[model samples]
Target: MEAEKKVIIVRFSGELSIKPDAEKYQAIERLCKQISLRLSEKNVFIDITHFHDRFQIKVSEQEVQSVCAVLDRSFGVGNYSLVDFQCSSKEEQILRLVPNYQDQFSGAEFRVRVKRSGQHSYSSMDLEKKAGAILGKTAKVNLSFPQKVLHIEVINEEAFLYSEKRKGPGGLPPHKRERALVLMSGGFDSAVAAWMLMKRGVCVDYLFCNMGGKSTERQTLQIAKVLSDLWNPDPIAKFISLDFTDSIEDIKKHSSLTYRQILLKCKMYEAASNVSKILGCYAIVTGEALGQVSSQSLQNLRAIDLSTRVSVLRPCIGMDKQEIIKKAYEIGTGVLSAKVLELCGITQGKAVRKANPSKTDEYLQSLDQSLIEKAIQERTEILLKDVDGKMLQSEYLFVDEISEGYEVIDCRTQKEFSQWHYAGARNLSLRELLANLKSLNKKKKYVLYCSFGTQTPVAAEIMQQSGFQAYAFKGGIGKLRSLQK
Candidate 1:
């Protein structure tokens, strides 16, 4: 006998349902397109039915759960159910299907809920009472607060049955909203901010200020690629990268340390505004949480943003750090954010908590405006999908290939280096490399390694970009040890 086919019932958020008829229709259409594209990528063929209240997706039982997981993470999905069995809508057939689910309500309180669509000889209440009659004997029926609830949907000639539903990320689909540029930092907060906007139906473009070095650019590009692939997946999304090293250097020379951070932020806004105007973005979004850092205070934000006419949106402003992190992990960017090489060298020492607008203005005026304009003019635009594949593959060298005058720096934590590292390798934790990048001798050749070699590319790229010859040790310390054995 052939196995029973399964289907997923997906429901849009209450917000989408309450929109005007035209708006609701458009939202549903966009959501359906996204769902179809995502499902097609998984090689899953499904029949989608858009009912008045929900979307019914029919697929094989084996792929039903996988399909549901994809829909669960997508925007505009309020909740979803997995329907495994379908039968004739007639009262006799539904009654027979009820007993098969009796094991689920075993020794637990259960409830029967029914919804009807097409003309049926029996009302929903009639079908419910019949299913309840057989269920009451095996399990206690608590209509108010049941541990398990069996849902039945009678649509035209068929009735669908399901017991559980999963919660979905409830928001309007992306591409329905206006386009905006996100000041992506590839960190925990910024990526989450971009996600929040995407979840709320905003089509986002990324604007990255490459202040840290090539490593920062590479890491930011990867994070942006992940965001583009998962949430939006639209090929038209642009990843705008600006080399802001000259801008940062100019700030260091002309601006005071107390207001340097705020001044640098202003320059970013100025550049973002220029870029946004060129790209036709409606606004600029950031991951800045209010008062999370010295530079994010309301005063500092106000002072830095004093010059831009482009609207700046901070979605994570009111949210706490832990809340933002929790969302990042939920959306699958937490691991990348955690592993990203952080550049703590931006600040000189204690930064101004609340920057005075007058002083900030003075500092901004002191710097050559041409610096920011030049960076924006030289901005490179690439499709988000192509950024990752375009990274210059780092060369890898084996232990035997280590020649004279080559410096081997272990890109691991200090504790890991202390535990056991290769002979003559200096500990330069990924965090420390960014902090003291300028001090490294640019003329010298360097060999970078990490546990299993996953992190060497980041350090090697940073070194290579800083005008030094760098190679990642193939297989890291693990490969070297194995070679010795």
Candidate 2:
């Protein structure tokens, strides 16, 4: 009464040369075991252990195909293959059936295609010869146009003969590495940039520079945390706090304020390089929109980065603000930290009249000792969490910008809010937001949210115009769930 079960065999290639750690192999084995467990095939089996039995560690012809499929797109893997495919035995094979009818097949000539397992006994040429001889004796041999050609395969102790062949996963797999530093600010562009990199499996490490000088505001930290929560619920990616306050001041003192905006970035890049070296990272990442701001200009990014030797990776380099924000919302970081991200205006207010080398140096020198020490201390002993509430994505939680107080309100969906919203939050769907708006006291600065942040902006705008200082959640509820998960 039960249906037949199907199986996919596997093998490893170049695995010996790579010499992956036991954990890696174990991970792969576990993935395989999980697959086997999920399927109800009685014949499902895998035997990578055979690699130890081979003289050259070569995969059998039967195992090469399936191994490749499973290994495809698997990062940190050297090579793999779908090796052995167990099928009906030679006696039960269809090729043998064709030979019996060779006499009846007169017009069309068919050739048996033999792909003997490399380690198995028979050879393709030999099988082909044997099949031809058998068919020749049975009927007029039309080897060139054989109408009943069959496929035959043998590996280990099993043999498969059929009229059709199972194809393998063709083409190279996508290559991805799970580590990159993303320059995250409480802005949509950078947030989206980081999200895109994360999607590519690049384990994101956030370098939040207080280039605008509002790092002291707690809002910055909140925004960073929201973004952090969305990408890594339990927080896998490290958020590295970078103090550009002093550097920005230094640039302003040494150069023209107009240029301060650009050179300030150079110093920030220099600082990022130092931080990256400390964190065992190299690439400097950001969410710079091409031509969006003076500092984002190719000339400016190149000018500023000239201070460092490390390569800069702008994942959202060519993207527009709307595109970046769209991605940020999709990734669930857009509105969670809405309140925190709004502090950027204050940081920008700190940029000076002149930001040249000498003045820049002075400002750097003048940085409050307490602030510098505190910032470093916080970053050194930071804790990171991912969306799943696991304490993994990162061990580092850079200082999110410091901020004053305002009641934090989350407007994300109930499910999202329950996963992780502020300790005190009101569940208000976007549809019911208008009715709830009437209930909110005008005196309170209303910050709104959606599940991952979709409706807060509209609500905030409406409330702000109605004489309330309304702020939206930057990273939204999705980010909160990521903390310590």
In candidate 1, which residue ranges exceed 4 Å CA deviation?
A: 1-5, 387-485
* Alpha-carbon local distance difference test for all models: 0.79, 0.49
lDDT of 1 by residue, 1-485 (tens): 86656778899998999999988989899998888888786567788899987898878776665476568668999999878578888888888888888887888999999999889898988888889889998999898999999999989998888998878889988773488999988889889989888888988899998878877777787778767766677767888889888988898999777777788788889989999888879999989999888998888888877968999999999999999988876665665687677553378789998888888888888898898788888887888755433252444422335677888888765645665666788998666675687888888888777654544565566567777778777655546655545
lDDT of 1: 0.79
Worst lDDT window (10 residues) for model 2?
A: 393-402
Best prediction by TM-score: 1
Residue 113, candidate 2: Cα error in Å is: 28
Model 2, 1-485: lDDT tens per residue? 53333332333334322445663454445434433332212122444332331111223333333233223323223433222234443533534554544555444466667654546445668767776666666444455775665555555555544443223222211122335666666677766776565444355566776644543323344445555443333234566665555544544455544555655465556666767676666587877777876556655565566567988888888877777766665555554334344322222434443334454445444444344344454553244543221121121211111134555665654544554455556677554565566777877655565544433554565566677766665544435434324
Give Cα distance to truth, residue 89, candidate 1, Å: 1.1
Q: Give candidate 2's total backbone clashes.
A: 81
